[model samples]
Target: MEAESRTFADAEVNRSLTPEDKIRFLRDMYRIRRFEQTALKAYNAGKMGGFLHLYTGQEAVAVATLSLLGPHDHIVTAYRDHGHALAVGMGMNECMAEFFGKATGCSKGKGGSMHLFAVEKRYWGGHGIVAGQTPLGLGIAYALKYKGIPGCCLCFLGDGAVNQGVYHESLNLASLFSLPVIYIIENNGYSMGTSLARSSAFRQLLAQRAEGYNICWDQASGENIYEVRAKTQAAMERAREESRPTVLEIATYRYYGHSVADANARKYRTPEEIEHYKTYHDPLLLWQKRLVDEGLLTGEQAEAIDLGARAEADAAMKFADESPFPTEADICADVYSEVDEPAGDAPRGTHFFN
Candidate 1:
């Protein structure tokens, strides 16, 4: 079956979500959409630095999946992470400030664009390297299990990252130890410029590979928030209760290229293909229509929510514009632990070479 033809009608709605919760989901999704739009605008106008991976078309995946997290649950994802960051409750001001390379960023301006991090929020990072965070995610789950924490970790990676050797290694370890981690492959159909079929060796679904490692696997549509939540919540429960790992592949898409740097985005894929996804499978439009259908929201309310999100994004951009840069003196500030500092107690030697 085609990726676009995936059925969402049969997916059950999460009944626990109140009318207010459903409205908040719409608002949160709109917030991510507007933020990505603002970031694209800034990048196109040369106001932002570094590679900008706009999460324009995959808002539902992040918003719905992260919504299931408990206080002890954690998350980590790849560089195309703006949507995930916002869904996890990171402020737009700090995220936008990171895009502007200002000191107020989550990484304090040291890690721009692809390295958004907030340990306090249990959002580990926005790792730049492909598949690099898999091991880290595995380790986090292992630690949680070791400490007897009743939580799990959601480790997200793109289709491109799944081919990396490190990811497979992480998979093996997760199953062997019964670690509570969910490996979500956000298969956007393309890896950089290469399409998934051409890049990876997969028979049916990518997540099916979990069978080899004796791990649970499932696939769902990223276009529907209800489906996303229903599928992910099951995996989270499995992890939390049984301490088992899962591999979930959500069929999603990206409107932009792999990054703003890829000029051949439109060339690689037909314009019609992009138009179809935008028209039929757009998460924001679909969710808005669903809420309206359920009598939980009206068209006017949805429009107002979008307008509010846009306004918030614009304000964040303005704040980023005014925020200070990291000073020269800040270079070595976060590099070393207090015990590793020159005047500290640790007997350190040959730590730095310059």
Candidate 2:
């Protein structure tokens, strides 16, 4: 028999979650919304640079999924990663600094918005190229298994990358060796102005793609944090204990265009679609409303949380504005790891041209 469909009402009634969990979930989702809104304003004002991909309507997907990992585990994602970085415990000031191109940023002003790295946080780093992180994720899982470490690697990619050769190869290798890695395909419906329907010939669900490689399949609404958290917990348990790899596809939508540069998402899809999502299926608003209805949070309390988030976002922009730009000497120092490397050389030091 086919499995039953799970709705938001089902998650609300069936999932086991605490009051504390709900509170944190709502707060974090609101925070992400606030941050993204602030970043858009900064981008418009030219305070922050680079291609900005706002994670406007997909906050819950990143927050709930990444929360499953402990400090020892690893995470890697695509360019739409500021939300993931925040959910994994990177401070707002540093994240904003990175977008500001300040030396104090997470990647030390080198990676910018597209490529963010926080190795200490075990976030691995975000990639700019489509499906580029797949091989890197497989390598990380292989290393973890080789070292006999018990931690899993959580690799995230957009629907656009799922069709790439590296993703399939990574799945084959991961499942073949029982590598402990959970791959999350955030399907926001559009692959840079083209809908998934246009790109892929197969109209079947994405999870079924896992069957070819023997990887287990899981699916959930990216808008539902509770469902996402519950499903991610099960996947993490299987990965940690059984040394298995699972493919999770999250059905989600991005309110903005492919990047901040794409104004109002008018190039490909209609503005009506964006307005519909904003009115009905907004991830942050859905969770907040649910929390209020469940009596876990009062409307006033939720409003307070939103105000607090707005304040924090404002502080982050200010922090980014005040942070100093990367100096010339700093850039020259980290240019090449070894003097023999193809990229240039240091003038006096072994690695630097100075």
Candidate 3:
């Protein structure tokens, strides 16, 4: 499939969004922002355990891309998956419970913040291994094609994963088999602490790499919800209809460190840079301004959305706090599908399989 080329003329398209769509888009952004903020607080208060990666600034990409997918579509993302899970209709209470290691979690507390799963909803999981989901996404698309299911797989990966061999191999295989998969690279300029320029020898052009695989590709501004949504819809449509793959490179930024553990992020990036992005380039703020300017939402109406999101998150935290922890016996059950034979000469009660 030949890659199509299109660019958004900022001046012309800036006013193209409808009032209703703008309000809904802003709500999506706010939901993610508030959700992350609450998760951060829970992590700091020792309520949430395990690895906690905040998707603060990358809300636009998740909300926008997810908005384009139908109920039949599948989604798989990386460790920073709270926003992705929420975008796909996972409840706030269940997600918070999962983070707190409660049985009510989407993974039933087996997979914490990094491993959310909703199989019935077609939301596969939140893979913890770097670039691990690439092949799995391909397999999903391959399965769909094998069953003649008319759907696509939306796989989200960070810029860091692009350097991994799995990415290239997945792309090659996806193209060769004509799988309906849209590989979205959320390029937030850094792979952990390493910048794109330092890590990538190719100087940070992901769509160009897709071309070499003989697939369709495009780059969208991850800071803009409309751009992300529009491009994602177009790409998914083409993938489903053409039975091919497409790569969408979304240029974005992460407000927090790699995880909540990095409290002092100023060592790598300046406060000024953070302030600049937070103040001006924030996806939520950008969408809010557009909605307010278009008269779709007043300043008061937007503020209400923010307040409502915070209230919802606060309630989720309360629910998580009252939830009970998993018992020691419960741990033994999920690890193995069937009981294993005891070691030679070992007693049944003395030793148990993990």
Candidate 4:
């Protein structure tokens, strides 16, 4: 497939964003920021446990791409998925409760930091295995294509996952079958502790690899919400109308460490490098600046959004604390598939069980 001529710089920005849209974008970013900040605090306070992947800096990509997709469209992503869930309309309280391992969680507290799911909203899960969700995402797209559904599947993977064999295989199948799937490479430039340079011999031209599979491809600066929204809209449109696979390489950065426990303390990259990226390419701040410069939002309005997000996150934490944990019986319930016993698998007098 050929690379799309439309680059991120060519993406339309001024026209697509209304005042209300700008405000909503800011609010969404604030919500993600506040939620992750609270999650970090909870982790330190020993309330929330497990590997917490904070999506502090990548809010633009989440908000932008999610806004372009329809409710019926499905999303499957890697472990870094809290932003994806929230962007897809998962309730903050439910997400917090899930993080807290309460029954009120989106996954009934079964899936902690990396297993959030909302089937009704078509948000599949936060699969923990690196690149494991690629095949599953392609399968979902295949099913959608088979059913003649008008929805596309957006599969998100880290930069590291591109090196996985499943990634290439899934891309090949998706392209060959003309499946309605968009493969998004969230290139935060690290695979856990290993930098992308050290991990992959091919380095960082993700769209080029997608081209080898005959899939339409594009790259976007994930720091800019407008660029993300525009590029994703184009790719999604192609997928829906043409029933073809597309790839979007989002060059993003993570503000926090790979996981909450890391605290970004280990020195793989220089402090100067991290600071440079954070200062220049901070997604939330970029959007905030745009909104303010365009006269769509004032500093006061932005502060209010931040304050509101913090309060909302605090309320969610309280709700999760008050909520009960899942019962032991519920454990055997969601993990297994309930199907009738085949043939004489079950005794004649006993009913089938999962």
Point to the candidate with the largest TM-score: 1
lDDT of 2 by residue, 1-354 (tens): 012324533554335567887788788888888988988889899887669988889999988887667866899999999889888888888888898898888888888887878888898888999999988888888888889888888899999998899899999999999998889889999999789998866547777799999999889888777678777777777888998999988999998889988754687888898899989889888888878878899989999999999999899889888888888767665654564354564445454335
lDDT of candidate 1? 0.90
lDDT of 2 at 170: 94
**What lDDT does candidate 3 reach at residue 177?**
98
lDDT scores for all predictions? 0.90, 0.84, 0.84, 0.86
Over the full model, what C-alpha lDDT does candidate 2 score relative to the true structure? 0.84
Q: Residue-wise lDDT of candidate 3 within 112-157, one digit each (tens)?
A: 9999888877889899998999999999999989998889999999
Position 100, candidate 4: lDDT: 93
lDDT agreement of model 4 with the native: 0.86
Off by over 4 Å in 1: 1-13, 339-354
lDDT of 1 by residue, 1-354 (tens): 434333433444476678898899899999998998998898888988769998889999999999888999999999998989999999999999998888998888988889998888899999999999999999999999999999999999999998999999999999999999999999999999999988999889999988999999999889878778888988999999999999999999999998999888888899899999999989889888888988989899999999999999999999998999999877767887753365645645754565
- Candidate 2: which stretches are off by over 4 Å? 1-16, 336-354
Per-residue error at 252 for model 3, in Å?
0.4
Off-target runs (Cα >4 Å) in candidate 3 are 1-19, 336-354
- Residue 294, candidate 2: Cα error in Å is 1.4
lDDT of 4 by residue, 116-225 (tens): 99889889999999999999989999999899889899999999898899999999999899999999999998888899878877635866788789998989888877
